[model samples]
Target: MRKTTYLLPALVVAIVVVLSSIFVVDEREKALVLQFGQIKAVKEEPGLAFKIPLIQEVVRYDDRILSLDTQTIEVTPSDDRRLVVDAFARYRIADVVQFRQAVGVGGIRVAEDRLSGILNAQIREVLGADQVTSDRILSKDRGELMIRIRDSARVQARSLGLDVVDVRLKQTNLPQRNLEATFDRMKAEREREAADEIARGNEAAQRVRALADRTVVETLSVADRDANVIRGEADAERNRIFADAYGADPEFFAFYRSLQAYETSLKGDNSTMVMTPDSQFFEYFKNELSTNGSVTLPDPVARAEAPDAPAPDAPEAPEMPEPFNLTPVDPAPVDPAPESPEAVDPTPEAVDPAPAPEAPEADTPPADN
Candidate 1:
């Protein structure tokens, strides 16, 4: 019974050691066997793995893709514009043995820290290159920039047994102090462009207005010149007609002109003229002239040039004559005297003061026909 008890204790201890040496690795994990801080073996596949119990231990790391958000950092681009940038990276541990050797006991946390530093440094180098600018970082080309950063970071991360699958820029913006200044600069640029456009428009408008004004002046001048030419032609034709009529009949023309003057001078409700009673203006008013129809009017031009005759000497001063009235006055008609029985027919032959000496009595008696 004492021998059975010792064997049973030994078997239980052996079972405990075997169970501790055998470990099952999960599909999502990578296992590293370490002997006193030195990497002895790596388990990259999911299944049972063996290790010397009490002398070695297995360290497992996630084999799935992992994500890390880098800290916001400030970088200056080629144009000297500073920017605040935020980024994220997707990665996985590709070499568990290398990872265990590099990170030691710190494991994924330490590896992540180192990867973050690598990503940040690569971002600065690529984004701050001579050809890169702040505009490129915030534009569609940012994808290209991120790819460059990932490639550069992947090279550096390989030393840490990490594979950088992709890197992306999440946020890229101007610093707080620069935001207002940038906006102001943009506003000023736009305003300058607008002012330039307005000036150009005004210049074009002025050009159009000037052209229109010149055209208007030219048109009006041409029209006025034509109008004046036509008016002068009309006046010349009128004078020609007047001259022809005057050449046809001087007496009739004079009478018609006098009638026109009278009509002009004696118009309206009240018309007055002061002149002598025997003035030539009333020459047609004489009964003898009116009955004879043989009116003669003095030529004004001849009268104006002729010297005045000497006044007749008067024994006494003549009395002042009353002013002539222009108003028409009808005279009383005189009745003809009745003919007497012995009245003489006053022919020119009977009116001779002295008888013409009978034309020496004809020698022969006149024959009657």
Candidate 2:
């Protein structure tokens, strides 16, 4: 029983010692064995590793790629424009031994802090170069600038046993004051452009109006010329018609013209005129009067009481006596007639005193015949 108890305790002690001496290194981690706070061995591969128990310690470090985000920094470009820039860096430990030597107990946090400073410094150096401007930084050239930053940062990070893979600017912004000023300037430029466009539009409208006015004037002038030509043609046609009518019957035309003149002159009851009786305007009236004065008329009562006249086909009748064979006489002289009462009157008897003559007997033969 004593021997068994002694073997059990010894075995337990041996297991504890073995466990303390043996350590596991994961694939994702790099480990360093330290003795008296001094690095002794490094285990970069995975699986089991051995270290002296109670005297040696294992330090582990991440082997994978890491990210470092820098605080927002203000940088001035070559154009002297200030910008707020936020950036990040991708890095990995190229030499774990060197990394462990550089930051012994401070670990990844210390390495990251130091790396952030390096990144910020490089960013300022490359972005603030003489050829770099705010416009270039904000454009596709920004990629070139980032490359320069990464190159510069890699050189500085080598001392910290870090390999810089890339440096990139995440966000870029202008100061609030500058943003407002830029907006105001853009607005003013747009307004000026709008004013110029309006002025050009008005000029075009004026040209159109002038052209329309000219067209209207030309149209009216053409229409007037055509109208005058047509009117002259119409007048010539009317004059030709009048000439042909007059040539057909001059005497009848004259008589018709005189009648038209009388109708026109005596349109109303109050019509009056003062002219000599022998005026050519009264030629028809004078001829009628002369005929009435020269020929004697037969009484209507005597003609009714006489016997019926013979037919045109019967034999000739005997000659009439001398008293029945009345002849025409000359007209008497005219005296000055009253003005107001007679001139206004339209009675037929007042116009002429001699009665109308009767027709001759159809069956009787005349002396001249």
Candidate 1 lDDT by residue in tens digits, 145-259: 9999999999999999899999999999999999999999999999999999999999999999999999999999999999999978876776666567555543444444554
lDDT of 1: 0.77
Write model 2 residue lDDT over 241-263, tens digit each, in one string: 54564455433434445545455
Clashes of each: 0, 0
Q: Per-prediction TM-score, please?
A: 0.54, 0.60
| Candidate 1 weakest ten by summed lDDT | 344-353
Evaluate model 2: give its lDDT. 0.75
Candidate 2 Cα misplacement greater than 4 A, ranges: 197-369
Q: After best superposition, candidate 2 residue 295: deviation in angstroms? A: 33
* Candidate 1: regions farther than 4 A off: 1-29, 33-41, 46-59, 129-145, 229-369
